[model samples]
Target: MLKSLLSDKPGARPLVEAIRACRWHLLAAAGFSALVNILYLAPTLYMMQVYDRVVPTGGIITLVLVTIVVFLALGTLAGLDVIRTRLLVRAGLRLDQQLAGRTLGRAMGSHETSARAGQVMREFDQVRSAIGGQGALAILDAPWTPIYLLFCFLLHPLLGLLTLVGALMLFGLAVLNERSTKSRLLKAHEASARAYAAQEQVSTRSEVVRALGMRRGLVARQLTARAEATGAQSEAQFTGGRYSGAIKFLRLMLQSLALGLGAYLAVQQQISAGAIIAASVLLSRAVQPIEQLVGAWPGLVQARAAWKSLTDLYEATGDQDEAHTLLPAPAGRLDLQEVSVRMSDGDTPQLKQVSFSLEPGQMLGVIGPSGSGKTTLARVVAGAYRPQLGAVRLDGSEYGQWDPERLARHIGYLPQDSVLFAGTVKDNISRFEGAADPAADQGAIDLRAVTAAKAAEVHDLIQSLPQGYDTPIGPGGRGLSAGQMQRVALARALYGSPRLLVLDEPNSHLDQDGETALMRALKRAAEAGAAIVIVAHRAGVLASADLLLVMNKGAVSRFGPRDQVLQALQGRGGPRIASVS
Candidate 1:
């Protein structure tokens, strides 16, 4: 255990590293607690002196002097306890600072449908709460158990023996508590994860669920999941509480039993009246830490489980954000050499051995039937989905070799289904630039956002809103039409005038005028020396393309200049003619 705690192996868990780094804090807190416990003996010794020395000698002056000095010692002890608690809180905050951002970043870069991606944050919260609070205090005080027992031994051998036996019994109960609740907590965690996942799915597809009258069924399913989780959690907590209650009972009874035993010893002239009370006091102090440990057991288990879960997730995802030397920003050159992507759920391959290349100022139109790998190709181009086989490169450097955030600045992507965050039109367009920074120059940010909106042809519609670019959108905010959402997403993709633009059916919800605006946007983007890839089934959307690619399943059926592919397809004019232009 000591080796594991001290070792900083290559793949050591982050939580372990946190504990290791806070070792000094833990030691300092324990040192202060030792002093407090020693001072705790002051009260017991004072009682011994009062009954055995003060009452017998009629020594009022001695009693007052002892009282004064013991109170001062206890006051210092309380102050030390306060400092110990503060140190633990600081350690917890430092641990949070170390892991929170990394966990959030990994979650953000992870797949949108990832179940564990969201769980890491909650797990970290559990760890932080457990570390800085009562659980840690109990652990810090636990080591003094043996020292308290030794004090009882000095008072009388029989009292010390009783304390040792009582401590063993209470420790046994604590072990049993762990044994009873460990599996239940694990089950509860799994059930809660399922419940959360079900609720997230229901929320994301709320429209369809409500429209189809499936809301009742979805809600019922979520409730059932939540019930199972809550039931398991309640059962485990009940078991832990039962054990803690038993430990408390044992601690109280042991002290009373010690007093009784010490009285018998006094009657036999083995000890004095002072020793009787001192024996009980010493036994209580010995049992105090064990009782506190029992109370803290459940929280400790939860933190341990959370640490294990986070470590497992980090290992499974392998999302090591390497900060290698920055390659120069990509120059709009993209190459795909026999790329293929396998579905995570063991579905059929989405794209198979599809290869293509694009240069600066080139615009490629991908026309295919539904599920013919068009959207997959667009995602690959935008670096949204890394292919399982082959490679994607920009400017002769592998995509993984570039810093993702920097690479993202040079890439623009509009998914098949448009998405809008809970923010203003300008915030969505500017990707929350000035909004995230309260001190940013808002006027300059608004001007830049408006320019992008005009480029996507959503500026006039936005200006018509109650607050123009600052108009709120999302749940409880101003609701935009489906076409408006698509246009705003388009404006977002075009915001930075990115060197590489991937639009997966950007005009899916657009009207005739919207389509015209989209054509102009594409033309302007291409003329500005940006490489654009569009996945569209609409023949009219293809008229502005400089190159054409057709997909008959997952394989490319045809690839050539726009006029050649269109002319050959026109000569044939088969079933695909309407979709491919």
Candidate 2:
């Protein structure tokens, strides 16, 4: 069974490995469950002894001895139950430790929306909780239901038959409960997820919503989504509640019937009076697991759905450990050969057959009108997007050849959005890199970050902040002006003295001085042998461009020396070519 579960597939590997790590604990919990269930029979046996043997004979010593044994067994049973619960909880924690980082990493790095990321996280939590929750305990106890039924049979054939009928009824009710509530619960979950995503979206962009007078409208939409989700959930819960009440009523009725029928058998002299109590105890025990299972059915369903979702996501993302042997450091050289990218559902490629090369110390300017695939090209070059055709190489090594984290140190990309995370200025500039050792020299790390800030000419600006490099900034760099955020982001791109820099609209929010500082920083970076690609609309920003590539409708229309490309554009009466001079 273990061998069958431990699949060789990449997607299953993480979850399988997590389960393997916790196998011993799970096995121990199962073992404890067996011991605990066996001990549960102590009460039935004790009651039977007192009624059939001690009560009729009036032997006080016999009653005392039986009660002592039962007490010891019950105590042991309680201890084992505690151990079982702790073992399962440990297993759940271990599973989380194993997969949470990977899940969050995939969420952050993938192109999935924030809503999808949140949904995946909730799914992962569901699976983790199911491992240790009452649902798991109920599942473990379910198999031992037969133990009680066996005892019932040993007590009397008629009692065993009665218990079987009651068990089957409870089982039927559970099945009915599942059928009636499954779709409703599923719908509720999806609606809740959508509502959560909408709320998250609005919260993240609260500033925009308030400024645009969209607060009331967005809130109304969110409330509507929430109401629908609540309605579905309430209906599902109400249906489940009805079954729960019925199950409770049926269980009580069955126990009473067992007692009454036992009495009839005893009065007829068909079975001993002690057998009556034993039959009632056994019947209730037999159906107890079923009742608990029914109550925990929703959690089990969620867990099953979450497991499938996680597996699908893992499969879609492919292997996380794709790293090979560490290569030597990259030099400031980049090459793209016949690279192309197409949307999954689109017929037209976003970028088509584009090729380019840049040696150390060279700078390339990309100019294009809106929708010319400039951003896509920049992403492809930055190793953010893998081309479906051809390759992107840094220092003659394909992007795939290098570990992503290691390669990122050699490549700097300032995206069009220039979004900054909430962190200290130093941490932001340092890309959140930290020393593993608590006693490590944090000063050295900060020094390097400060140097990057200085390189980008943002050092003075940062120093002007309340705490200088230690100043905390909110998400999206809310503490800084737009130009300051861009400059700070530029410093981040310059950190580690990366071999290649890709800047998209780097000066979009900058004033004249900020633009001049940015241009100066780019020149210094180039002089220091960093190959750079700058995508921009401002021709002035491309003044020092060694080469110019003009893009037209996702294809390179012209690529040559800066002056030559400009002259061609001017001569052809193409989209107005602004002069750098």
Candidate 3:
């Protein structure tokens, strides 16, 4: 099963693999951090020198020189720190750039997976942000923490032991933070992704919600889901906060304890007063990495979970090769060989061993009652749903053997509720070519868009707009009615003289004139040698179908010439017209 879904393409490695390529940047950043840690010793030493040498000998010039040297070293260290930060940021960006396309491609296939997988892009973003966030910075500085402990050891053995015990305590707290928060963080992330998908569904059906007075109900549901996710996130943060606060408290107390111990040693003649201050500073530095780690633990957990999600997607998108077979243009010789497609639950097949055949210059109308698989059959015919059994063949070759992008070019599918994005009517009709590129292939794209509009018999209707073809018609700009959106979508389906056209409820919103225009377009397409399958309920459109397939309860009830099926249906007790599925 994994082999079938996962692409075997050479470039399809997980995003984590790309992250490994940035190790050099990480290494260089670590080297800079090491230097920074070395420079940190300057403050302790300068203080020690001032107390022991300058003050004791009354050497004012020595004190001034030591201060100047320490400031210069600190200034250089600050510059190196900035450069290292920039390097990490750029590395994160480069990692994101390398994997963004791959991640989006995986997301494009989300229609086949769980709703939560639809937000793979968000998961990728999380990983990218965490890579450059404070969590990663803390990890970089963590390794040098022991060096500070070693400095504390050189100050006095008792002080070193005291700081080590304290550092270990904070390290234990950091581990506790991860243990307490990791699972909640993962759950929160999943909940957030699902909430996003739910909100997306609500946005698409905003008109329906308002019309049915379901706004309050829908809003309540969305808020409830979001609140649950936010609650989980808050719990994780609260856990992290407790650990961070405890680590800070322990570090402060340990610093004071190190001072008290050092002062005791000084009185015993084992160490001087200057050594006490140095010991305190070194002890704080020793535990600082553990404190930062505790603070950034939640982000680290989120990033780990995101990595797993993204990696799973990359694996599932399996080796769908783009090197499509250079087969000759099909003659629209379509065949469904005992095809079957199980619904989402896999308990019952929506299309059960359905079979059909069509040749060029023919139009097949599929009619059925609601829940009779009319839409499912249309989707299978258009290659949107891969059959669970048998084959969808074009010109004697299975469509599964061809790259989907190439197969789509020769095919046009207008679903039950055709949708348009944020663009002009012309752009929507040309499938965004008019909007995507106005400077290159300008003339050719315009000609294709106009030709498609003319074929759909809506050219004059479009010309009536203020800017004609260029008039914006999506969500933000002037919106078109349902009939207009369907006609424009029909024009999109009619583009490029496709060899195969599959439409579901083409006239679901059209008026009588629009229906007439659709008939003319169907006839023209058939005359041009395109095989068309139109799912419709209206008998008027069926008048032009060369063949008819009547479906009932997920099976083909009858298949023959249009007249034969119509004659049979006329003799029945009730006319089995198509219903929206």
lDDT of each: 0.82, 0.87, 0.83
Candidate 3 residue 369 Cα shift, in angstroms, is: 1.6
Model 1 poorest 10 in a row by lDDT: 1-10
> Which ranges in model 2 have alpha carbons more than 4 Å from their true place?
1-7, 111-114, 343-349, 435-441
Which candidate comes out best when scored by TM-score? Answer: 2
Residue 129 lDDT in candidate 2: 95
Evaluate residue 137 in candidate 3 and report its C-alpha lDDT on the 0 to 100 scale: 82
Tens digit per residue, CA lDDT, model 2, 1-581: 34643446786677788888888889899999999999999998898899999989999999999999999999999999999999999999998999998887775566333355567888889988999999889888889998899888887789989999999999999999999999888888778878887787788888899899998999899989999999998898999999999999999999999999999999999888889988998899889988998888777776776676677667656545664778888778899999999876578888999998999999999999999999999998988887889989998998888877889899989999888989898888988886324575788778889999999999999999999998999988888888889999999999989999999999999999999999999999999999999999998889999999988889998898998989888888876756886
Residue-pair clashes per prediction, in order, are 0, 0, 5
lDDT-superior candidate, 1 or 3: 3
lDDT score for residue 12 of model 2: 63
Best by lDDT: 2
TM-score of each: 0.90, 0.93, 0.92
Better of 1 and 2 by TM-score: 2
Candidates ranked by lDDT, best first?
2, 3, 1
- Worst ten in a row by lDDT for model 3: 1-10
Model 1, range 1-581, lDDT digits (tens) per residue?
Answer: 34543324434355466677777877888888888888889888888888889999999999999899888988998899899999888888888887787777666675434565556788878888887889788887888889989998888888889999999999999899889999998888878877887787678778888799998888788889899999999999999889988998998899889989999999999988998898988888888877887777767777777777666655543545456567776679988898888768757888888888889899899987787888888888788888888889888887887777778878989998887888888888888878557899888878878888998988899889999987899842238888988898899899877889999988889999999999999899889999989888777778777888887667787888988887887777622645443
Q: Give the lDDT of residue 298 in candidate 2.
A: 74
The number of clashing residue pairs in model 2 is 0
